[model samples]
Target: MENWSENHNDFIDYERDEKNKKIHILIIYDISENKTRTKLVKFLLGYGYRVQKSAFEAIVTKSQLKKIIKNISNYLDEENDSIRIYRMYYDDVIIFGKNFSIEDEEIIII
Candidate 1:
């Protein structure tokens, strides 16, 4: 789904280590309206994001292809829009044999 994201074109040069897994997050919404907020949350949740309040997080062994479906839903809305992507170093230190390393990433909006 990242490819379908607004700034997806800008990620061409960036690289991720295939040996070390990482979690990528994308959040988009209109802070001024409840309808958009609700829609965004529903869409994320419908796509399996563990949502809590205004935030959602999820981790999986392999990238979920359903992610693109979630992103595409954003366009069905007629309101103006903005999207944010945050990639974080994912760690499962408590459980051995289960983990992924991530590079420092910034919140990107486009």
Candidate 2:
């Protein structure tokens, strides 16, 4: 029988696509400037991303993700802004939910 390590190695042996699929990503940004956050949210939505409870999730291509992130980064205030990008897998949100309460979950992306 194959050992666990052998099985893991077998799994890793398969060829995987380097290109990112149209996977959903959660993007969290801190835009303390009045109306800045809202405007940016609108911009993302207008570009085909969805915004939920201050978290944005969308099926973005890898190239598009880079462009979107660049646009967002450009708008951020160097000293006061930040963005958290999360790759949304099947259970990531549920796993994280264990540590964050419902209210706390409001700010999370994945």
Candidate 3:
């Protein structure tokens, strides 16, 4: 298994140009400005669910991910804010937790 370093790109690349395949993404961030953080939260809600006060989980394609990253890069305070993104395929992860609910691209209409 290959690990990532600061000098290396750690993002995933599926064979056969699987840009349309949906994958899980975890986004965590910390911003010093309240207004910026709040705005970012609102923006991210369109793409995923908020799993924590400062963390979110999203299922998106490679193109959507690129767009999300690009949009957020504009206002991020690189010197005072920090953000991390982790991606995993459905079969690439194992979960062990308490009362965890899975969020898929499902629509529940009553």
Candidate 4:
């Protein structure tokens, strides 16, 4: 929303646009290897919230999305692993089973 293509190098300054608001990312993956799956989960945890065993929800900017995809690509086995990244608007998301919500505060895992 903040002209990400022009300011690709400065992701820290990326801001949400009034039109787009927030970028909600839903990540779903299936990896045959246990170790790879664990590593993938760990990597994703740094950038998102795990809503399920193999799914995650994140609020990210365009540059951050690019970086996350690049990181995920490195761990994926083209032949056996599958990863899906769904980009949607915050208002478009619908949650049923669990009470999940995105917070504006920083999450610290200690």
Candidate 5:
């Protein structure tokens, strides 16, 4: 999660968006080392809920997201690890499953 990710562009401050407004961030990581991965997970957990085994979703301010990226970068081995972060809206998400509910909401089984 840096300025060089091919899957994402640089973190841009949208001109239309207000400064300090909170936004949803989805972070998914694949690290080769278990220790590093575990540490990253622990750090991320303090910021948001874990959506899956290796993914986390947080509602953080732009500065908070930037801080996360800055701090986590130190623990990353870019040659062997991959971490992707996306900015999205919580309402845009739809679920289709059982036994999994975000923020204690009921899960829809279809």
Candidate 6:
């Protein structure tokens, strides 16, 4: 079998173009090791806003999502760590606290 990492670029490009739409992604992860968890959280902070201690929300393109997953996977211990990415439509996401909102056309990450 071919290695997934080897073919990921092609897959990312094709799917990104075909699905050229913005998506709301919620990332949640649990890591037992402090160093790894800190590294993962810092990495994620570069891509999204932290909504909670261990959760984040971002408006991302398909390509960005693919990249995020591929990069974050490197920090995970397959047997001990867990990461959950939830994809939701913009309109389908409802927020009830802190007035959190995602822009339709863009996300300005400072």
Tell me the whole-model lDDT of each prediction, alpha carbons only. Answer: 0.44, 0.54, 0.69, 0.71, 0.69, 0.72
All candidates: CA RMSD (Å): 9.5, 12.6, 6.5, 5.8, 7.5, 4.1
Question: Residue 20: error of model 3 in Å?
Answer: 7.5
Provide TM-scores for the models.
0.45, 0.57, 0.71, 0.74, 0.74, 0.71
Tell me how far the alpha carbon of residue 38 in candidate 5 is from the true structure, in angstroms, after superposition.
Answer: 0.7
| Per-candidate count of clashing residue pairs (backbone under 3 Å) | 0, 0, 0, 0, 0, 0
For model 3, how does the per-residue alpha-carbon lDDT over 16-41 read when each residue is reduced to its tens digit? 23655676888899889999998888
- Estimate, for each residue in 5-105, the C-alpha lDDT of model 4 and write its tens digit: 34543333335433454457789999989999999988888778898988998876555677776567766898888898776557777788876787644
Residue 2 miss distance in model 2 (angstroms): 44
Q: Kindly give the stretch of ten consecutive residues in candidate 6 with the minimal lDDT sum.
A: 8-17
| List of clashing residue pairs for candidate 5 | none
State in Å the error of residue 4, model 1: 5.8
List model 1 lDDT by residue over 15-64, tens digit each: 56355443454444444467766666665654335433554554322334
* Candidate 6 clashing pairs, residues 3+ apart or interchain: none
- The top-ranked prediction according to TM-score is 5
- Residue pairs in clash, model 3: none
| lDDT, candidate 3, at 82 | 82
TM-score-based ranking: 5, 4, 3, 6, 2, 1
Higher-TM-score candidate among 1 and 4?
4
Which has the higher lDDT value, candidate number 2 or candidate number 4?
A: 4
Checking candidate 1 for backbone clashes, the offending pairs are none
Candidate 4: C-alpha RMSD after superposition: 5.8
